[model samples]
Target: MTTVTSRPASAASMAWAGRASGVWLRLSVTAALLAAAGNIYALSDLEGIYGRETSAFVNQAIAQDAVDLAVVSPAIAVLAFLARRGSLRAYLTWLGAVAFMTYNYVIYTLSVHVGPLFLVWVAVLGLSAFSLIGGLAALDGQAVAARFDRAPRRPAGWLLVIVAALFTMLWLKDIVPATLAGRLPQSVSELALPSSPVHVLDLSFFLPAAFISGALLLRGRPWAYTTAPGLLAFLALTGLPIMVTPFVAQTRGDEPAWAVLPPIVGIVIACLAVLAGLMRPLPRATGTPVKVPVSRTDRRHPPHQDAAA
Candidate 1:
């Protein structure tokens, strides 16, 4: 019989992760700046910018831009700065912010019409995507999991599962029936978008991520600890835009999705609560050592060397 041992990450891999961290930090900061610029322009009354998009979609876009400018962009910069110091909690939060930007602009890049800020949108999208990828690459999942060894996984896991299910049902209720009936969902038609970017993105990526993260969390897997917080952050950020879109629509004299906003607000609050729960038990500064200051008496003489005193 041959025996094999699991080895810790090699110095080379660790060094690579360090380099990746630096790369992502720079990329995320650039993405944040670009997102801020792009969002400002989107929120502005730039002539022909929104361009033939339905009022509903444009109003939602305004809401998203507002949130991105006021919340997401600043979050990315601040969290990335903190993550650079190498805390797992900070890294997860930073990753979540990048994911929100990346996910958001994917919808913006595809849905919004071509205009002056198109390249800026594309640039932010690309930077955010790479930052998200690099941030994930830099994670040491097992090490991250170890810090949350005392976290209440079961409740948090179930909470994530419930949130995932709620969103799944929310989308699929519109999609599944419409698909079977061979007709477009009302939202798609109403919005006049070439396609349903939210549906496509959610079904293809975000929802699945939620389901996987939730399932793994239930199993108490090491990777789940690393994923759940970031997922929660994305949900929280995503929900904010959704929650505000209705109000934005109302303010603009469009018919607001008032019924949905309350539920969305609830979901956002749930995400935050679970995020705090998951993060509560984590030891601060994952790999960093804490220093204790020596008192003058201790500095002057060691306890075992009484004669020296």
Candidate 2:
């Protein structure tokens, strides 16, 4: 392992991250408030906006909006507020929150047909996408890697791998049978939607990302140090929505997914614990260029440079 020691904070590198995200932070607060307002009114069946949705689907949406209002919106606002102080941990967490909103609103704008909140959803999605991009732009990958020099990599890596494996298996259990039967799956049928966007997203994008992050982390890859924290946040945030959805269903006179709760809760707890370990060494304020002692590998010339010689 490369042992990296801390040095004086580099005001230049860390300052940019805070400054760059400032405008986005202000914009996100507005968007988050709008989202919160939408969530509150959605439960009232405002203007019969949900008139066309299946009972199950409406319940699911209610559950999601509840979590968004009660947990996500407030959490992101706080993270953004903290990130404005230039903490790497806070900035990364803020980025993850924006990522989650971007992901959620994609489903809302594309799959759900609520005309009243459609524009609100679009606004949230656009802002989050842009903010995620901007936040990533300000991130110093090498600096972050150096900070995590002694953090617990293996547990976080293995947790990601296990989460990915379990989810992949869960989604496939529905998909493979449907593919074989040449029919739409029950997951879709219950929601009365033509297709399951969650399944598509999980199988195509998120699960693969989880597995890749975990694998790279296991190998002590530098990139993983920067990438894994946000991913861990994402997983932790998502578990809230999934855990609450079933209860929302029960309250709304729909079938509760009780069986899903135990495993999901367990995953959330494990992810949070490991994530804390990974982030423990990270500074509450980040604004420094790292200066790890040079080693043999560090002294090695690039292949192109060697060729030039």
Candidate 3:
């Protein structure tokens, strides 16, 4: 049986990857620390940014802070560890972490009106954006793709599309009515906010990326391999909290449980699908097998040959 093996990535690519990983690690850690501190320490009875009850807003903030610490912080730590070890899975996971941080901080900056943590949110936002750009620039799409099996690509892509479409429907369900009526969305009004940050961000950025990346993967484009995992990771991490936050709010008597339950279930299922697809193993490539060094650490040993397509 013939097999194909991957060659070591170019030195320049390796260097770039190392640098990008370092940047992501530092920035993510810093952001996580600052966010945890700010959210936990900076509590007060301040007016809502839009107009919702201050108490309600504060409760939501507390719940979200818990999610940040419990969910996001751990994910970032794991991804950073993986990236440091030179795993493609870690690299892709890092991308998602960066995206999540960026998206998350942006929301905090816009939504939290009267807090000392505003500056912290701004700093995190800038750092996360830069980290994402640097990380994506450093990635070698083909090399990354070569590390993964092709079988899950289509399914993962479709899952992303479905998640994105669901977000669009959810947000538009509120936005389109308000837009047509030339009035603010009821949720926006209830919150006393000028607009919904979730709606704005989803419509402008996350949803579009999810749809595009999913489409690219389905078409078997090389870039899709690079983009899909990160998007999936981002969706999974962000989607989980979004699913749970409503339940938290409901338990606090801030919202009805039934109102949010269906979406929560849907998002949970979709996130699981994306994660499962990404975790699929790489298949051996077809062709004559060849040996290559996995990294400098492995150079003293004989080259390990593996089949991968």
The whole-model lDDT of each prediction reads 0.73, 0.73, 0.66
* Candidate 3 per-residue lDDT over residues 95-214, each given as its tens digit: 887788888888788887745567878987887788788778766665555455344676787888888897799788888988899999876876678888878888998899999988
lDDT of 1 by residue, 53-123 (tens): 88888888888989999999998888766555444466677788889999988988898888888899899
RMSD of each predicted structure: 9.0, 8.6, 5.2
Worst 10 residues of 3 by lDDT: 300-309
Clashing pairs in 2: 10-288
* Predicted model with the maximum TM-score: 2
User: Any runs in candidate 1 off by more than 4 Å, and if so which?
Assistant: 1-20, 281-309
Off by over 4 Å in 3: 1-19, 42-56, 283-309
The clash numbers for all candidates, in the given order, read: 0, 1, 9
**lDDT by residue for model 2 over 1-309, one digit each (tens)?**
444444333432343342354667777777788888888877777336677888877777877888899888998899877666555666667777777887888888888885888888889888888877776765556566555656789998898898999999988999899989998889898778888888888889888888998888887776676678888888988888889888888887777889989988998898889888887744433344543332233234211111100
Each prediction's TM-score versus the true structure? 0.84, 0.85, 0.81
Which of the two, 2 or 3, has more TM-score?
2
Off by over 4 Å in 2: 1-19, 282-309
Clash pairs for candidate 1: none
